[model samples]
Target chain A: MTAANGNVRLAARSLAPAVLVMGKGGVGKTTVAAALATLEAETHGLAVLVEFGDGESGRRALGPTHKGVEHVVIHAAEAIQRGATPLFGSATMAKLALGNFAMRPLLKAAPAIRELAMLESVRQIVEARPGVRVVVDMPATGHAVAWLRTAKQGREFLGSGPMFELCDRVARELVAPGRASIIVVTLPERLVLEETLELCESIALDPGLEVARIVVNRVPLPLAQECLVDARALAQGGGALAQPAAALVSLLEARAAASAGAVAALEVFAHGPHAIWQVPLAPVDPSARDVARWLRAEGAA
Target chain B: MKDPRVIVCAGGGGVGKTTTSAALSVALAARGYRTLIVTIDPARRLAGAMGVPITDVVTPVPLPAARGRLWALMPDPRRSMGTFLDFLFADEPEAKARMLTNNLYLGLADAAAGVHELVAMNLVARAATEGDFDVVVIDTAPSRHAIDFVTYPARLAALLGGRTVAWLAGLAQRSGGATATAPRGLLSWGTGHVEHLLARVTGPNLVRDTANLFADLALVRERFVALTRRASELLLGERVAYALVAAPTAAARDDVLFLAARLEKLGRRPRAIVLNRADTQAAPWVRALREGHGVAPSITEVLDVLEQERRTRATAADALAVELRSKLSWAAVVRLPYVEASAPEDIVAALSTELDAHLTALLPDAR
Candidate 1:
């Protein structure tokens, strides 16, 4: 393994118990979560990859199954059922309450109920399994923020009830240092960079919820400045190669410029406190193993 | 021939659906059709692309060169539910006031995904019917399940119009004034046990507050039903058109197919499948470089890597287009070139120019 790989391995050794990967849609959240889970499992002996929506993303990223890792899809309805059983004092009573047509929709329509149940379910999983590290691939930005804020909203709405207690437990665990950390993934495009900056600012507002890392995915490698100068000279010569050479140079230059701008923006936002990692653009869609390997190489670089 | 009254753009995240929606509206407005583009994305990307601030109010887009006018409505998701409730309870000020301040109602309005989407659509329906516009273009949220929002209004209308809500509201009215007493009736008999179980789990205060909220909502049930019905019709009617936006990645292909299936299940089909950034390869340039000799190795090395990446991306896009064409033969597949601009407005303008050429294919009567 290279020095970068060694550095990534060292960084992977100090992860929190639960890592929530969040970002805008199509920003490689699933890929990062899967790679983190793989790395954590290698060190911890076992890790759980949690998916909130359909389970297809986890399977696609990890290729169905991997050693030392387990994939769990948390559905809100099932989570509500599991969480309410103990509170209702009987499984049958929980089922009856959830099964009623009038009550089911009402509960479903209630704000933060689904989000609270999902978070509570994750808390239960972590408590039930002491040694396994958990990695969650969160949904889009809007829904992810809603899920994070559910605890506070639920507490205010339901002041003193079993649901309130559940919310408090989830909220405490989320804010506990070294218990859960959020990793925000983003791309190097203009709009994506702005959104990433905004997301980091929002995450910073919450006192205890740590922004563990800022990962810039799909960044292109910077080309040598002399190459661009040479290509520009060739373009001015008016040869057949001049046009294609110039096109190639401009494309590369544009991508490199965008990557540089994104990195600079991240640097200003991070201000030497937050960790910023850049993942080079892969030739094709990468799997969990590919990303883990890339992480290692990136760390050494 | 008449233009489609409603145009819905559906796709996965980061595929340029918002840009496409904005461009489409720009193109339509240029053709002398007054258009309003409504975006349900909480990211508020339309404002960036259009270079205008959009709120819940319909704001005019300054398109001085266009033959007709352009407008936009980007409702804040947090406030949409309250705005919708205000509109629903416009006739009864007291009920509206109570419902607005109700804890349960406030909680439901804050983060309910279904309510946010429903209210956004309701706003679209209101704009389409009440505003003076030739066509309404909708930019849906970036998710496979975003299509599900089209069904929410109908489902909610059915739920509220049923006897269950009425009975629950009645129960709340009877319980609020006096001590709880069991009533002997067929509907109440079965629901009484369910209510007891629900109260036990969610707490009695929650049940009472929820029931009271519904009781207030029941005052305008007919108006709610009418609004939802109109929204459903505008979304799912024959005059509505669906445009599926996609990119050239494997994931985008899967997302397009998934969205197509969902639309199909809803008895609808995309009128046009827009392939954004499909033409990324500079083939003539690559061929010329390959034939030329006496080039610097530095330039050659950079060109070689970029050419490979471009070829791979182009090939993937071609393969995706072919597969989608074969699978969804009914929809017209349109390709949009990758714009090299960096600014959001520049990208939107370039895309709008590209879309201007395919208006007829996207909307058959758009000419």
Candidate 2:
């Protein structure tokens, strides 16, 4: 591993039990999820980062597709279908054709198919190896809420069916205190924060689920108080900096207010049950790996 | 395809799909087409943007300034289902009344995972074909994938296959309604794997009632099939156009790409991609203030950081735009500036004027 990888390993030593990163669209959930997964891999020996879609995003992260919905649904459907199949003397395997028919329709008709598939896939990943954890980069807020709600909903809707058993199992994995937790990632803007709060409020509503952490990403770095005080004093002298100072102060004020709004949201979030972390605005856009490295350094700091 | 009868904006949540629909409606209305924009955004930003309150029923938006007529509605799916049931059994009043008043039917309809999509499809199809509005714009739910969850072509037809409906209706007519006699165990309350599971879960009483409701639905299955067929045609027809609205981020563009791909498989692709809230690069005056006529040494340090950050953001935005173009097949990509307008009216008004010239030149007359 490179020095950057080594640094992440050190930081990963104390990650929370499980992490699920979610936010509104374009709120950097993928980068945050990737970062957390990298840090998780450090302590856990191996970590799986799962995306719920076509597995293209997963391919970008870990090369080959690490069992997501597309792969899991078929396996799950076959398993469930086999449950309905009788022991011996089955006719032409035609009874099982219904199973294949039911796969996409079941997954599509009920949110349960996708939900159970995703949850089971994560469980399989962690269980496949010793000391491994899984991080699910959940979809945006609206569907994320639906995805999270499906386990219990499936149990309620599909009682006694093979699908119900899986839902119950998934719910148990999610509910056990330290077994799983969700981390909400959001920007420092007002609208985004409002949406984040709405997400947190829903997370709080789920009975057994825990809000692990909230990362407020892409915040402007605060200027040094002394530097600002000196600048204020020097602006009175009116040199080459006067006009820029006037311009800078207003811009600085907006930046400061945005940061303040983020801090203020944290204060509100603190009333709820999650720990919060802030990621400073980067000079350049950072990828998932870069975010992981930065998070490690941030954790160290 | 400027004057297409329908424009549907699909994307992930909070990517300004509703705003894009509102703006497109405004522009089309300005171009002298009577327009209606339907939004399913629970946030209901459309009404706020139009300076009106959206209802389950369609309401004409107060467009004192815009030239053409405009209306908006948020379909309450259950109510739409009720109305649709009426239409389905229009010939058989007794059957329609019996189904409408049935508690089991109401429960099934209310709990329907498929009804919402069906209702949305019905509304858009009607807005295009039945309603007097010259143009209909749809702002759908922010589904997670490119193939959105809330709406898909012939979705109900696929999920509720004709054979499955026919079989259920046949059984229900024999056993559920007790109109015909049959030997037990075919679709008996206790037999058939699907019915067994349903009876086990919902209890025999509810299952029996639901089976009876299906018998009634069977009486109207032909109409339902015809309706879905109409919905499918309205969607894939030449008059409809799809557009993708995305923020200038990897995730949103990723959704646009996925949506474009999915639409392509259906032979229906997005006509335009709107990149919302794009950062405006520095102006000549601002550039001069930073480089040419610099003042205030105290502010110089912070100013330098701010300028550097702005440049970085601008570069990133441009790169993302280029990346989307390279990845996706759609070409009519437009960027809306990240202006500071909060209210819905201001956003709609600003977007209308801002998009007028560009949209006019880009969009073509419908064939």
Candidate 3:
């Protein structure tokens, strides 16, 4: 690690880096978060990755997360059951609890009980290990907003339940500077990039939450400037079998245009110069190692 | 399309799920099935595809090309929940108003994650019987949340379990007697007497009016349960067909496999898997411009790079398709090329063509 890396690395340890990796459903959030965790674990000692939903994506990503890294998956339904156990008095209460939640007849009640339960679970994990790096792999854009909204509502609605206390703690930690950073991942497709920028704008509404850089994933690996010029010169030389050269420049240019538009939007939405990172479009699926290395390289750049 | 009773297009977000939902509805309607396609959080682009505004009210889209009627709408959860309340408290007018106005009941039916699904399924159940629609196509929220719509009945049933209803009814009964217990014409009692009377009958804080809600909704709990069960039965039962729509990415492919496994665990399975945007031809213009014409080196270089990218993407896509087929042994995985259209309708029209085989397989004789 470079001296600059050492400085930031030390800062991260002091601050207890907690990042919420967010994106649309198809965007590679798990891939990016796991890769970042793997890097932190290699650089620092303690890092815990948390997934909010029930899916195995987080656990699967954790397998390659370097040693000493912890993986904690919070299945919302199960968490709610844990919370409902006292009320249900037994497993049979699971159904009634789920129904009441669905109907949301109670304040701070709704299927969002899962989000509430998940928030409480995250707070415990963060509080228990003060200096531990917490990486939360959040759900997609739409559902993610719902989770954030729940944090705000839980504070207002639940007068004095254990839920209100957890929500207050989480809401504070999530917005605290250097304590939590939200990283948004996006594919370079026109629509996906635009949607991501919109998400960044919406997340900005939360005065307490701090959004990090936008990670534009799966950008086709770009060639050096001189190499592209040479390719363009060769293509302009009219000849047989010159089609490949022309297509390369056009394809690369198209990708550059898409990225530029998204970046421009990101800058405008962020209200200042925003940090934007790009990941090379993978030839095949990338492993955790590939992503970690790529992140390091991007960081250096 | 087999029975054309119910069709749910489900997958993670950004996988073209919303587009797939619209196209399937268009195709099903064209094939002579009276269809209602309900999308949640429909983007403006998609709402524009139907050539009409898809709002809270169910509006029929005039599909000039389709043989049967086509209708579309985004479920209004508040309204649907109200309808549900009306059905539940149809017998007791005053009680219905109280429950509707109650903070807890209103809140539950309003934004509970399952509220949409509950409202949607309620809509679907209604459409299945009295609405006279041959097919009710559901386009759900992506990810595991999509499954929330399918399993919502259970959660809702538990919410209104027999005991919860009994408790509410019993409260209402006691409260009714308390109203009478106001010492035979309350003009004689002072204001303190009235306050005492209310305190005695209303049960303490939190549980106050708890009985009234039960009393009002007591009659419809069984019917509500019946409605929810029937909707879920339509979804998981033999009458429904499931299609998993996914973009051709390794991550999305992995999710498709997981979703299939999840469904299988529930004793259900996707009728077919729709692998959308499968064509690795990331840039279509390059292929069309370069084939036989001898282009300049600059153009050729660009073409070559584009071709290489395409080939690489195609290879990755083929591998994912192979993995999907191998793992989902029972499902027929259909691949759709990268749809080039930007306008919502054009994309839907293009996807409908790509999904022709699977749709045909579902209906067989419709076309």
Which lDDT tens digits does candidate 2 get at residues B85-155?
A: 77788898888888877655553443344455555567666565555777777776676443333354245
Best candidate, DockQ-wise? 1
Q: Over the stretch A145-226, how does candidate 2's per-residue lDDT look in tens digits?
A: 6666666765665556444666677677763456676778887766567767877887778634556667888777876555
lDDT for B151 (candidate 2): 51
Answer with 1 or 3, whichever has the higher TM-score. 1
- lDDT by residue for model 3 over B1-367, one digit each (tens)? 1345677778876678888888888877776778888876554536767776745667788656544488887765435666666665677677777886764454344345555566566666655665678777788777755675556655545655544445434334444555543332322333233233333322333234444554455456677677667656766777677888876665677667778877887788887788776774544445555664544455456556656755776776787778878887777777776553334576788677656556754443445
Q: What is the TM-score of chain B in candidate 2?
A: 0.76
- Report the lDDT tens digits of candidate 3 across residue range A1-301: 5865664464344433577888887677888888777778777776888876564776666564368678888876677666555444455544443444212343222455667677767776787887778888887776776677666665665555444555567677664566677888887666566677667777777534546667788776554555467657756776753565665555456556655665666665442222566778765567666886777666656
Determine the C-alpha RMSD for candidate 2 after optimal superposition of all C-alphas.
Answer: 6.6
How large is the interface RMSD of candidate 2? 5.9
Question: Best-fitting candidate, measured by lDDT?
Answer: 1
- CAPRI grade of model 1: medium
Summarize candidate 1's per-residue lDDT along B27-122 as a digit string, tens digits.
Answer: 888888888888887475678777567577788887553444888888887677777777788899999889878887766564655666667777
Q: How do the candidates rank by lDDT, highest first?
A: 1, 3, 2
The number of residue pairs in model 2 that clash at the backbone is 10
Could you tell me the C-alpha RMSD of candidate 3 in Å? Answer: 7.6
Chain A structural similarity (TM-score) per candidate? 0.90, 0.74, 0.80
Assess each prediction's global lDDT (C-alpha) against the native: 0.76, 0.61, 0.64
C-alpha positional error of residue A17 in candidate 1 after TM-score superposition, expressed in Å: 0.9
